[model samples]
Target: MLSSILTGIGEATQLSALVANLVGVIVGITFGSMPGLTFSTGLILLLPVTFAFDPVTGISLLVGVFIGGMTGGSVSAILLGIPGTPSAAATVIDGYPLKQKGMAGKALGMAVIASIFAGLVSLLLLILVAPLIAKVALQFGSVEIFALVLFGLSTIISVSSGSVIKGLIAGIIGLMAMEIGLDPVMGVHRFTLGYEPLQAGIDLLAAMIGLFAIPQIIKDLPRSQGETGIKIEEKGITNQLPSWQEIKSCFGIMVRGALMGTGIGSIPGTGGPIAAFLSYETNKRMSKHPEKWGTGILEGVAAPEAANNGVTGGALIPMLTLGIPGDPGTAILLGALLIHGLQPGPLLFQNNADVVYGIFAALFIANILTLIVQWFGIRLFVKILQVPKTILLPAIMVLTIVGSFAVRNNLFDVYVMAVFGVIGYFLERYDFPTTPVILAIVLGPTLETEMRRAIIAEGTYTAFFTHPISAVFIFLTLVMLFGPTVKDKIAARRAA
Candidate 1:
C-alpha cells in the first residue's frame, strides 16, 4: 500500500502533470466562485480534452479541479450571499446574514478558516481510511452494494429539514427522470418520448443546470435591469473573530458540521452542499439562539462553510478507493481514471501508491493554497456581486449557451438547459427545494444499477430486506424516509 501510494505521488510530480493540475485548479476555482457556474459544468466541459492526454496527468488534473471547486463554492456564498454552487446554498442562509450585519470580512474570515480546517480533517481521514474501506468494500457483492446505495439514498432525510414530503416528491421526480434513459442492466430502452434525441434520455448536466442554476438566475431577473440590487455596506475588511464568546459557543457547530459533512460525503451520491445545509439545520436545532439563526449569526455562516468544504475530502474517499464517485465532480474524476486505464479499487493502493499518496499529500497543499488565495482574493470575488446585471446577465447567458454546447456539441442539450432554467425559476418562487432534485438526478443512475442487481440475485419479494447488507441499508433508508414524517406528525399532534 505504501509503495503504490508513493508511485502515484511520483507520477504526479512530473512537470506536465503538475502544470495540468494547476490549470485545472485555477479553472475550477474561477467557476466555483461564480454563482450559476458549477464544478460539474467545469469538469464536463473539459472531459473531451482529456482524450489526448496521459491518463495519470489527466485524472490528476480533474481531481484538482474537484477539490478546488468544492472550496471555491464558499467564496461567493460568504461574500455576496449568492451561492456559487448548490452545496453553497446553506452557506448563503447564514453567510449573507453576517454580510448584512456589516461583518462581511469577518464572515469570510471564519469561512476560510473553517473550510481549510474541514478540508484537512477530511483529507487526513481519507488518507488513513481509504485503503481499509476499500478492503471492506471487497466484501461487497450485489447485495452489499445495493444496501450501500440504499443507505446513500437515505441521506435525503438528513437533507430535507422543514419539508420531508417535498423532499420525497423531489426524489421521486429524480427517480422518474432516471427511468427516461435506457436500462443499464437489462439492455432495454425505457421511457424515451419516441424521439431519437429522447432515446438518450434527459441529459443530467442539462437538467441539473436547469434545476439549480437557471431557476435562480431567472428569479433574480427582475433586478437585472436595476443597479446590481445587492447592496454592499462596504465595511473595511476585518480579520477579527465575530466574538470570542460567539466563537466559543459556535465551536461545536463547526465541529459537528465538519464531521457530519465528512461522513455523508464518504458515501457515493451525496456531496458537500447537502452536508452543509444538513449541518446548518442540525446545528440550528441544537443552538440556544435558534431564532437568531437566519437573522445573521456567525455560527450559521461558519458551520455550513466549514461543513461543505469538509465534505470535499470525504467525497474523495469512495472515489479514490472504489473508483465510484461520491458526487458529480468526482463522477467526472472516475471517468478520468478509467481513461487512464487505472482501476481504482483495493489493488489501486497496492499498485499506484505514489498516485494515491501524491493526491492525498496534495490535499494539504491545496487547502493552504486555497486559504492564501481566498484571503487576498476576497475583495475581488465580492466585486463580482456588484457587477452590473445588464452586462453580467448577458455574459452569463452566453457562457451558459457555450458551456452547454461544449459538453457534447449538441444543440438538443442547449434547449434542454433553457427549459430547465425556466422550471427552476418557477419552482424556487413556490419554495420548492431544488437541491434534492439535482441530487436525485445525480444518484438516480447509481440507484437503478445497484437495486436491479440485488433483485436479480435474490429473485424473491424479500430480497430488499432479507440480505444482511441489503437489510441494513433498507433499514436506514426506511428510517430516513419515515423518521421526519413521524416527527412532523408528532409535532403537529402535540400542537393540536
Candidate 2:
C-alpha cells in the first residue's frame, strides 16, 4: 500500500496537474463569489468545458473549482450580505454586520486566512489519518448518526443569538417543512396534499435560497432605476494581512471550527453550511465576549470561514473511501468521477491512485493559488457590488433560474426559486432568523433516516445509550440541547 501510494504520488506531481489545479481554483472562486451561483452549479457549468482537456487535468481543475468555491462563498456573504453559496449562511450573520460597519476589509482578511489555514489542516489530516478516520466514521451506526443529527439540531438554540425560544420555534417550523413530502421508508405521502410537486416535498436548495439570498434582495429595493446605482466602495485595501495578535487569538477558534467542520462533513447528507453554522455558534458562545459577535469581531469572521473551508477536505472522506456523498456538492463530484470512469470507494486508492493523489496534491497547491488570486482579486471583486441593483438584481434572478435549472434540468426548480424569493422576503420582514431554518433543511433528512433505522434495529429504546460510542454522542447531544438552560440559571443566580 505504501509503495503503491508513493508511486501514485509521483505520477501526479507533474506541472500540468499543478497548473490545472491553480486555474480551477480561480474559476471556482469567481463562480462562487457571484450572488446566486453555487459551487455545484459552477462545476456543472464548467464540467462540459473540461471534456476537451486531458482527464487528469480536467478533473484536477474541477476539484480545484469545488474547493475554491467553498472558500469564495464567504466573500459575498461578508461584503454584500449575499452568501455566494448556501454553505456561507452562517457567515452572513456576523459577516454582513462587519461589512455594514465598514470593516469589510478586515473581515475579508480574517476569513481568507482562516479558510486557508483550516483547509490545510483538513488536508493534512486527510493525508495522514484518512483511513483511521474512515474507521471511526463506520463506527457511527444509525442511532449514533441520528444522535449526531440531533446534536446539530440542538445547535439551533445557539444560532438564534437573539431569542432561544423563537429559534426553537423556527427550527420546528423548518422540520415541519421537511415533512411535506412522501415518507421514503413507508412509501406513503404525508404532507403533499395531492400536488405533484409537493409529493417531492420542498426542495432543500430552494428553501435555502429563500432562507438566505431572497431576503437581501427585498431589503435593497424600491428605488427608481436611474438613481438605483449602489456604489460599492473598498474602504480599505484588500491585501492587508490580519495582525499577528488577531491570528493568535483566533487560533483555538480556528482549530475547533476545523475539527468540528471535518467531523460534520464526514457524515453523508450534511454539508459545509451545517459545519459553518455549528462552528460559528459554538465559537461565539464559547468566547469571552459573546455579546460582541454580531457586532463584527474578527473571531466571527475567522470561525465560520475556517469551518466552511474545513468542510471542503472533510467532505471527501466518505466520497473517496465510501460511495456515499457528504453533501450535494460532493454528489456532483461523484458524478464527475463516474464520468471519468473512476469509481470512488476503498478500491479507488488501489485502482486509480494517481487520480486520488492528484486531487490531494491539487488541494494543497490550490490553496496557494487561491490565496494569491484572492489577494489580488479582492479589489476587483469588491467593485462588482457597485453595479446597479436594477442590472444586478435582474441578473441575479436570471442566475437563480439558470442555476436552479442547471441542477436537474428541471423547470420546476426555477419556479421553486421564484416562490422561495417571496417566502424569504416575508420571513425577513418578521425578523425571524433563517439560520435554524437552513439548519433544518440540512439536517432533517439525516435525522429522520437515522432515527427510523436505529429504532427498527434496536427494537428497544436503550440502544441509543447501550453502546459506549453511541452513548457519548447521545450525551453530547443532551449537553448541547440543555446546557444553555443550565448557563442561564447560573447567570441568574449570580445576578441575584
Candidate 3:
C-alpha cells in the first residue's frame, strides 16, 4: 500500500498532471461561476479535449474541473443569489443574504475554505475506505433508495422560509411539474397535453435558473433606472479570510457536512445537490441559533459548500471501484475513463494500481489548487456587486435566457424557464419558499421510480417497513416530518 501510494504520488507530480490540473481548475471556475453552466457541462465540453492526453493526465484535468466547479458555484450564489449549479442552491440561502449585508467577501471566503477542508476529508475517505463504502452502497436496493429520498423530501420543512403550508403547496406544484414528462416506470406520458416537447418534462437546470435568477433580475429591473450596484466594503474584500476563532466555531458543522456529503455521494444516482441540502438542513437542526440560519450566517455557507465539495471524492469511490457513476458528472468521468481504455472495476485496480493512486493524488492537488485560486479570486469576484444595475440586470437576463436554452439546446427549455421564472416571482412575492419546489423537482422522479420498483419487486407496500434500511429511513422521515411540531407542543405545555 505504501509503495502504491508512492507510485501514485510520482505519477501525479509529473508536469503534465500539474498543468492539466491547473488548466482544468481555471476553466472549471469560469464554467461554474456562470449561472446555468454546471460542472457536468464543463466536463462534457472538455472530454473531447482530454482525448489527446494520457489517461492519468486527462483524468487529472477532469478531476480538477470537478473540484473547481463544485466550489465555484458558490461564487454566483453569494454574489447574485443565483446558484450557478444545483449543488450551490443551499449556499444561496445564507450566502446571498451575506452579500446583501455587504459581506460577500466573507461568504465567498468561507465557501472556499469549507470546500477545501471537506474536499480533503472526502479524499481521505476515498483513499482509506473506498472498497468498504462501495460494498455497502451496493446493498441499497430500490426500497432503501425510496426511503432515503423520502427522508430527503422531508427537508422541505426546514428549507421553507416561513410557512410550512405554503412550502408543501410549492412542493406539490413541483411534483406535479415532474409528472408532466413520460412516467419513469412506464413509457406512457401523463401531462404532456399532446405537446411533444412536454414529454421531456421540465429541464431541472432551466427551471432552477428561472426560479432563482429570473426573479432577482425582474426585481432589479425597476431599480436599473437610478440605482448603482451594491456598495461592497473595502475592508471586506481585502480581509476576506475568516478568523481562526470563527473557523473553530464552524469546525463541527463542516465536519458533519463533509460526512453527510461523503455518505450521499457514495450512493449511485444521488448527487451533490442532495448532499448540499441535507447538510444545510442537518446543520440548521443542530445549531443552537437555528433561527439565524438563513440570515446570512457564515455557518450556513460553510455547511453546504463543504458538503458539495466533499461529494467530489465520495462520488469517485463508487465510480472507480464498482464501475458505477455516483452522479451525472462522474458518469461523464466514467465515460472518459472508458475512452482511455481504462475500465474502472476491480480488475483495473489490480492492473492499473498506479493510475488509481495517481487519480487520488490528483484530487488532493486539485483541492489545494482550488483553495489558492478561489482565495485570491475572491477580491475579483466581489467586483460583480459593483457593476451598475442598468448594465448588470440586462446582462444577467441575457445569460439566463441563453443558459436556459443551452441546457438541452432546446428553445422549449427557454420557454419553460420563462414560465418557472414567473411562478418563482409570484411565489417569492407571496412569501412562499421556492427551495421546496426545487427539492421536489429534484427528488420527485427518484421517489416515483423507486416506490414503483419496490412495489413491483415485493408486491406490497409493507416491504418498505420490512427491510431494515428502508424502515430506518422511513422512521427518520417520520421524525423529520413531525419533530418540530412535537417540540413546539412540548414547549407550550411546559410554559402553561
Residue lDDT tens for model 3, 1-496: 5687788888788999899998889767766876655666566556556656888898889988999999999988988788978899999999999988988888888999999999999999998887565456557788987887787677677667499899889989888888888988889989898999999888776776677677777665754456565564546554388889989999999999898898888765467899999999999999999999999999999999999988888888867875655455775677677657787655456678888889999999999998898887666655643555677557667777776776567899889988999999999999998767776776677789989999999999899999999999899878877888999999999999
Off by over 4 Å in 3: 1-119, 126-131, 222-224, 232-366
TM-score of every model?
A: 0.73, 0.63, 0.62
Error of 2 at 7 (Å): 12
Candidate 2 stretches greater than 4 Å from native: 1-118, 222-362
**RMSD to the hidden true structure, all candidates:** 5.3, 7.4, 8.2
TM-score of 3: 0.62
- Kindly provide the TM-score of model 1 when superposed on the true structure, using C-alpha atoms: 0.73
Better of 2 and 3 by TM-score: 2
lDDT against the true structure, per candidate, is 0.71, 0.73, 0.81
Query: Taking the tens digit of each residue's C-alpha lDDT, what string does model 2 give over 1-496?
Result: 6665665455446677677777788778876787655666556545545555665676778888987898888888887788988778888888888778777777888888989888988888777666665456655678877776676576676557577777787778778888888885787998777878778777665555555456665665655545644355566546667789989999999999888877777665467778898998999889999999988788988888888888878878867775455454665566567556776655576577667776777677778778877877898766654555666556555556555565456678667767766766776677666667766765677678778888998888788889777788678767776887899899999999
- Which residue pairs clash in candidate 3? none
Supply candidate 2's per-residue lDDT for 138: 57
Q: Evaluated with TM-score, which candidate comes out highest?
A: 1
Q: What ordering of candidates by TM-score runs from best to worst?
A: 1, 2, 3
Candidate 1: residue 44 lDDT (0-100): 56
* Error at 444, model 1, angstroms: 2.8
Count of backbone collisions in candidate 1: 14
Backbone clash count for every predicted candidate, in the order shown = 14, 0, 0
